[model samples]
Target chain A: MAEENLKGLMLPVVIGKLLAPLPLFPLQFILSRMVRGIAQRRPEFFARLGSHIDSSYAIDVTELPFVLLLKPNPRNPELTAHRRPDKVASDASIAGPFMELFKVLDGRGDSDAMFFSGNLKVSGNTEAAVCLRYALDDLEGSVIEDLLHMGGPALMPAHLLLQRLRRLEMQA
Target chain B: MNTQAITPNAKPELVCPAGTPAALRAAVDSGADAVYCGLANETNARNFAGLNFTPDLLEQGIAYARGRGTKVLLAVNSFATAPRTQLWFDAVDTAARLGVDAVIVADIGVASYAAEHHPQLRLHLSVQAGASSPEAIRYYCSEFNVKRVVLPRILTVTEIAAIHREIPCEIEAFVFGNIGMMSEGRCSLTNYVTGTSTNMDGVCSPANAVHYMDLPDGSKTAGLGDFEIDCFAAGEHAGYPTICKGRYLSPVRKEPYYAFEEPVSLNLSSLLPDLIAAGVTALKIEGRQRSRSYVQAVVSAYRRAVDDIAAGRWHDLSGLVALTEGGKETQGAFQTKKWR
Candidate 1:
């Protein structure tokens, strides 16, 4: 009877371990979809954010790591809104170009049409934002596209599950 | 601008440091061909209390330097984050409007702005930019029309020679003052301990955070935040207690050792001829926060050495012993890679 009980428990554990990474795909998909939804609703919010970024300004962003927004001016578009994920803060503002820029970046996984459409914004000073967008789009369209495309939407959960299964395999 | 083709002079420029109006005059009168200083704020790296000059003082300093055939370069080298970028922008605008010779800059954003707004003004890449590689140097030069690049302290004389061969602009190396082992423009160890950041804020071991305690055993203890930097014997020299330069106790060794560098000043007087032969265009003496006396002495000694070498005289300047840090000096990386 004990042997039978152990076998039954073992089957579920094995199955659960095998299916663990499966959920990560759906989770990422949902997150990406939600981000897309937000981007579709508000395009101008992220567009105007860069106008306010100053060199001496310090923002305490809670939702994201404390990244130096580094808005040099509303004129130069070459400066991208780089986010240093290591230094996140809580009290920082979420309005302007940052909102839409991050949203479009987050949702790029959903659909190309969503990205190509006016759904994504290069807000603030459009000339400067366009320059920043071109740089990012070029970089993304080049070497990085392979990785993002290979993963598709399903890569997220598969990656998570693979990590867990690999750990189990190591133990076994 | 002089459009005529001119042969290069063997005597390089004598770049000096000035903190206040008095220091500026002292540097120029004592024979500084050029003096670099900043306004009294975080816009400059030497953001010390009661140091630097005001806008009025800066105008006077420029006039004084011009009158003495000495050029003045305004340093707005500190990195500006956000909201505070206006200060840097305004500083650059004011410097250009005042007909300053050049503005020493390190921040990419600041450089970009200066290039766009003030095309007539010449730009010199500050040491804080950390453009050690030829590629990096080229990028700055091509992007901002940088006339000169201040090589960082980490590169050896050989490396400097190699870089000089590749670049078209003038190369200025630090001949005297602090020898920073840590990477410039990226260090945050001091900021982690103290609120003031070395890269962005331009102030390291800011006075507000430093505390010194005189111990009973004829030793002094320097503390930053909760950590003790070093405990110096009363007779031993008490130096600037920075995190990287501080003595530490490790599990492998019980005795305290200088993990980075011993508190010593970099004096390259012995390597002047070698540096000149290496194609260095100018010699810069650091310490804008230092007093006029310090500036006068260091500048005078270097000026004499540079002039003597140009005049084809056999000069030995090792007599500048008292002016060194802890009365000890090194050739830094200029002589040999291994300083020992």
Candidate 2:
């Protein structure tokens, strides 16, 4: 996709304003359960991180209302949300559009390809981000599938968001 | 009457790299004749934090490959330190016990131990062994019964053919991957600061000591330990921070330049026919530390090239440029001597 096409997918001002007052509890609850399921599915995912198992990652979707903070602590894996103004104490940050980052997570695309194409921007601890990419690359299952299945009614808004993404992709 | 006879050489084995179980499957599915991997220890050269396989994972990978008639070569290629001789020996023993097709070894001590303890195991000399000459190659073949030798990435195609004519064992050459200017199994220059070597400890610049900081001027700085590798402009492709590959200053030159070598991947794709004619037994794809996507793309591309050569079909492997380091590639000393 073109740079402008992807950049345009960032949450518009109107949507951001609408989601500003929305409670994060439902999304947090859904994410917590998804993390539990993912942890159970791929137990070695965290173990694969080696020394970076303790490091936290900020998975940012450009223009999105909230960013995801993931800590693959094998004992107690954590995946929480942090909106703007809430500082994310992360070791590394990987920022891209939702679909771009989504492609990497679901194994449709790779970090190297995404990075080289200038779609994804990685900052902060380079090594830790690399370890995370290595771990994620080794994932055989789909993270999107895990999320979609976990969220029933709570995922309706997310489902609508996916439809919007698809339309934008079609327009491109 | 003038007549030239043309008989294509037998198809050389396509040895793909496997960083993880997923990568192993990707290789096998993509028409690899063999897949090489190392255990998740200091046993292999690519000892990155999250790379390599566990014994259980290896077992699964081996099983998956075996079902598809793809051979598995386990690499216990790192030097066996005095304190950790048992670890290398145990790795060799595991290879034998697991029924691996062969074990790639570099260190003489490790080879001797494998030959002594596991006489039934097949030993392939790793490039890290630095067995470049016929004498060195012969010595290894005689002492350790090495079936094949992965020639270092520093030899010209003519030199490879010359070595092949002289050596008793089969020859394996690197067809594509990172172009290391330093000698194989000797990742030492700036390693004194890091207290590790990719050849032994399996880390060049250890991950924990690496740092990347964004500058106020829209440039980025990469630091490995106390040494700052390079400062890249905002849009420049940021490479991995290995000191030797980093640009540096000098008294004579106006600007800092790549003293060692640039980050160009070794791509010997166009020389597939020359390699086959030269009696190369196998073609190894480097990057066991790279992702499964890399494994899949590279292996499949080479697979088509090799197969096209066999079936007498048109082949274009130029699309693989996207996968190479910084989108730049070199045949690296394969076609000509880069060093005097």
lDDT of 2 at B233: 84
Tens digit of per-residue lDDT, candidate 2, span B1-340: 1112225556799999998888899999999999999998898888777888888888988999999999999999889898888888999988998999999999999999999999999999999888899999999999999999999988898999999999999999999988785587776865776777777876777777777777777677777888888777877777777877888888999997888889788888888878878889899999887888899999999998888877766678899987888888888888888542
Task: Give model 2's DockQ, 2 decimals.
Answer: 0.55
| TM-score of predicted chain A against the true chain A, for each candidate | 0.24, 0.78
Q: What share of the reference contacts survives in each candidate?
A: 0.00, 0.49
Q: Local distance difference test, per candidate? A: 0.67, 0.83
Which stretches in model 2 have alpha-carbon errors above 4 Å? A1-18, A116-119, A152-172, B1-9
Q: Residue-wise lDDT of candidate 1 within B1-340, one digit each (tens)?
A: 1122223485688899986665688789889989999987898888755456668769988998999899999999999889899999999999998989999999999999999999999999999999989999999999999999999888788889999999878999899987876488778888899778987888877755655666677576767777899887756666656887799998999899888887778988877777777788889998775545567778888888887777666666676666666678888777777774
Candidate 2, B-chain TM:
0.96
lDDT of 1 at B237: 64
Give the range of the ten consecutive residues with the poorest summed lDDT in model 2 chain B.
B1-10
